[model samples]
Target: MAVRKKKKDRRYSKGCNNQALLPRGSKGWPMIGESFEYFGAGWKGHPEKFLHDRMSKFSSLVFRTSLMLEDVAVLCGPQGNKFLFSNEKKLMQPWLPTTIAKIFPSSQETFNSGNSKFRKLLINVLKTEALQQFVPIIGDVAQQYFESKWKGKKEIMAYELAKTFTFELACKILLNIYDPELIKYLFGPFEAIGKGFLSIPIDFPMTPYRRAINAAKFIRKELVAIAKQRKIDLNEGKATPTQDILSRFIVYRDENGEFPGEDEIADQIQGLLIGGYENMSTTCAALVQFLAELPEIYHGVYNEQTEIAKCKAPGEQLEWSDLSKMNYSWKVAREVIRLTQPSQGYRQVMTDFMYEGYSIPKGWKVYWTALSTHKNPELFPEPEKFDPSRFEGNGPEPYTFVPFGGGAHLCPGKEYARLAILVFIHHLVTKFKWEKINADERIVYNPLPHPAKGLPIRIYPHIS
Candidate 1:
């Protein structure tokens, strides 16, 4: 809402002074930029094509390119991952494009910085030990999902069902809103808001970006109403404060002993909603797709889950210990996601720095992806093969298989994914075998993979 400018550079070397040492690549045409080129490749199912193309042409790990709204240096592989992941608020800081930032409850001062209080609070709740409590709840949700949405339906769209399933899980676990009607009501705006993150920034009639911002407003209206009523419920002892994030927020107080405003509460809820949205759902669909395609891999998961079920009493849900013993199954999951990681990560250089003999100017955006490392034959022998055993003992070398990303800024939902995916896989493999309706279904990237026809599949329930 405020016009802002960067302070004079009294700290770092001025203007690409080490231009000779900068990575080699083109920024494409002015204004219109390489955004189209990047999106074109993604829409064609090659989300990493833009980066891979430049890598082969320049033969360099780091290359200069323009993307979205700025000139960025595309950094590749483990070392690149290390630089971006490890240097949070050190040599670099988190970043989002100005146009896209408008869609978020953003402040130019702290936008994507590691110092966000909201992020800190979120991590505190989502980290290792705290997530163990959600295991059975997630397992129960998975069972219900199959019973209502999957079982008895001879054929269904896997991706579409997966999106709804994950959204419901998020509502139940994160917000404590387990009513199906309520979840579906909130999902419409959530779905629309998600598209804006991957769309052109043009905020006009029917544009994805415009729709996204509009959805955010609609979501806030509903969430604010809920939050306001929740505050009254907490004060009157009609609600337990220990329930979910919305309830938790009602009782939380700042250093000044005051509760956050309604808008602030909505923003935090938005943060929680979007945190694992794309990565988790897309990964869930892909995990099912890959396992369905590879019988042997699916068998491994099936065997592991069967053993775990045997250990439990009849009709008991999956527990944390059961989740722990899902090693081979987890390995299959790791391998599946490893083969298809996020398109890329974003970082903004905080100061001029030198890396591997290249001078990276301060303030330039940095993009990193694991595909450079994930697909390298050296890191993974016969990388094309989906051998879950590759993840058996020690797993792929550090930073080489970063499907959930790495370091301080790593996605806080890694543990959530581990349990949630295993829960879904456990139910999937245990009850029935599946087959793809479209064996050659294509993967189109709308910044994330969407299988052709949303991965329609026929569920052959086990013949008892």
Candidate 2:
């Protein structure tokens, strides 16, 4: 892949010609060089300020440095996202390659092996039918956690609790791993692998990158063992190959009637661990924060749950059929995801592309910041306000409000994520009434966006 370079123009060295491109930063650094000191200080913490500075300096320009070996382009407004996301073939792969690749190395190979077989397997398993089977399991797991861990608690760390819950749920659904002790052991390496993904990819001794590599190795070993055991069980007929996500993958046959080997299965499982849990857990925690701040929304969700409770028999559990009646809850959940843009859409331009009279040279890192696009006043009026009503009549543009991204690379497990979040919220609202113990709680986006402080809330059980 050849790196794109900006053509020098001595006429506009001091200032930008286009007002639309003003507010960008200076293109002083060499191509592929790192301003590590500034980046390490906190690039994500102050995104708005950073973007403003960059925009002021360059004015719709891409800055490149050889030291860092990456191109940085600040995509602003709705048109920018459309041009980038709509052209999936030209710009499909994400920008955080090192981090993402480190987390799911096997998936990378599977992805490179022509058709994304692992991604297809994930879609087959996590789609509408496959996910329905896990609802009961997810609900039971959440209820147990709430009963055992959060009983009689006035306040709790929302992020930590959400992470633990989603992690356990993901393990059960993806790998069929249910042992608590083993989960604890596995989670440590998983966390390390996640950390390695975002850090500078240097394999020096005692570095985060090296630790992440070791963690990835440990995860692969564990998953390979599990896959082997699963295969043995399937061969022995000890386990009736049910329609779980992993089982579906195990039985999946390609054009040649070939199933993926254990290593490939391990890669997909690792992909689910990193890609599935972090985003959903953050969304879950953020949903709590949104509800805490907006009492009306909170009440609306509770009322939906109440209505569902009435439709059920004395002790009937909530099922997929019941989700239809919870319209308001679903809207609120969608709004939460829309407002809290957990991840950015990243891609590299494979060839020169033109948009709005500007040329996006090949090999440049082109990205669509979901935060900026989702906050577009044209698409989302009062963009900062938490209004679920915006999606009432006709929703925003198709590619504009993409929380799971767009095109063929759209998240395979999006449906599973939605169900898990809905179930968790339903349980929270049905079981207790919560009020924010701390009035001033904010979200922090690092590794992934999450509530900076554990959302501490006072919960009182509903008395009917």
Candidate 3:
């Protein structure tokens, strides 16, 4: 493998005056064997603090660590971020999918194929007409979920419930499958796939990595079957092609008059499944937790829902048009996503790069912690405080509020995720009143960051 050659005589800016230039390492190990020690456990637990400390000490940061794994460089401050994400071809690649592919080998191929097709398919299916059709479906699904799950005096884990909700919603929209048992089986494999993304590359049996590989295989098989059946139905004229995304994808032909193969279709489906659920689940749990902690925000959200309800009759469901009118609910959801970014964005440098007078070698793994950007006191005042109203007037700087990431590789399903969250909040606020069972419950940020103590909130039917 070719290593990134260090550049000579780089110029430094005033902002980076105190930055430290990274040193070179031996052929085998980078950072002279100290790479793992600094970037491993400490970085994981308190990433922001660790990065900040390094920024203050070093004029520029670089790590010559293990060549077996990519070398990681921490780019601190706003100017550093702009330079990194802007160079799309040189520094950007899907690091999360690469991590996942370590366990599920098939995932790498799936991701590569899906990236090519997602832009076309998303533009076609996520428009106003398609979203309008989905409004009723989403409303019905949410209502049914609440009725069955939150009925009676029962304590539930918010994270777990959010996971189930996301799974069901993804199934209804993506594959158009609605069978309960089938949905349960599909969700299990999908969850395993997510776990595999963060697991070590070892494929030993009983390990999370092995299970993730198996789950990927299982999901691909199911997707192939579904695609084949949909194609058959389209050919036989047994089904009318409606506005569903799957149906559109089945018939979509490219410029060369070619449709995607089974593997390609499956890959896109997998990406949608992963993108659809994980972040949304974390955001949903955080929104509920935030509402519980701040009654004023909660009441404001409730009033927004109430106003939305008043727009129609008492029993009427919300429409897409009503979404614009519910600005407060939308702001609350955006703030929650901004604050509780589920995953830190990771990108691998495809070529040797220069930023802020420092050398960032090719094949190095670069990470942007959303917490660092989102919680920056300069961008957001009183960064530790959970105030949704901060976004009420002028929101944070561009690219600063990157909970779903940014740039060309920005999540295509962002609209869908936001819609699902808003719809979920609307239901909870209008249909039920909830209070935290434990005021001091701690939120766990591991395994995709959710309420550690299950966000135990008792729900009662709202009294008009």
In order, the Cα lDDT scores of the candidates are 0.78, 0.69, 0.70
lDDT of 1 by residue, 64-115 (tens): 7888758788888778887777777888887777776777754334456553
Q: Would you list the rank order by TM-score, best first?
A: 1, 3, 2
Looking at model 3, residue 202 earns an lDDT score of 73
Off by over 4 Å in 1: 1-20, 105-110, 255-258
Stretches of candidate 2 exceeding 4 Å from the true structure: 1-68, 74-76, 90-96, 99-107, 111-115, 200-206
Candidate 3, 1-464: lDDT as tens digits: 99989886333222333543443332235433443443453324433454454555553333233322555665555555566567655555655535566654655644543365557667657755567788888888888888888767557667788889988998888877789899998899888887776665678897888888888888888988888888898889965567466777877788788887876777777777877888888788888788878889999999888887877875678788888877888888887876667346556767655665565656666766666567667778877687777776777777667766556656667677767888999988887777788888755544356565778887778767
- Which prediction has more favorable TM-score, 1 or 2? 1
Assess candidate 3 and give its lDDT.
0.70
* TM-scores for the candidates: 0.92, 0.85, 0.86
Better of 2 and 3 by TM-score: 3
In terms of TM-score, which candidate is strongest? 1
How far is 265's C-alpha from truth in model 3 (Å)? Answer: 0.6
- Candidate 3 weakest ten by summed lDDT: 59-68
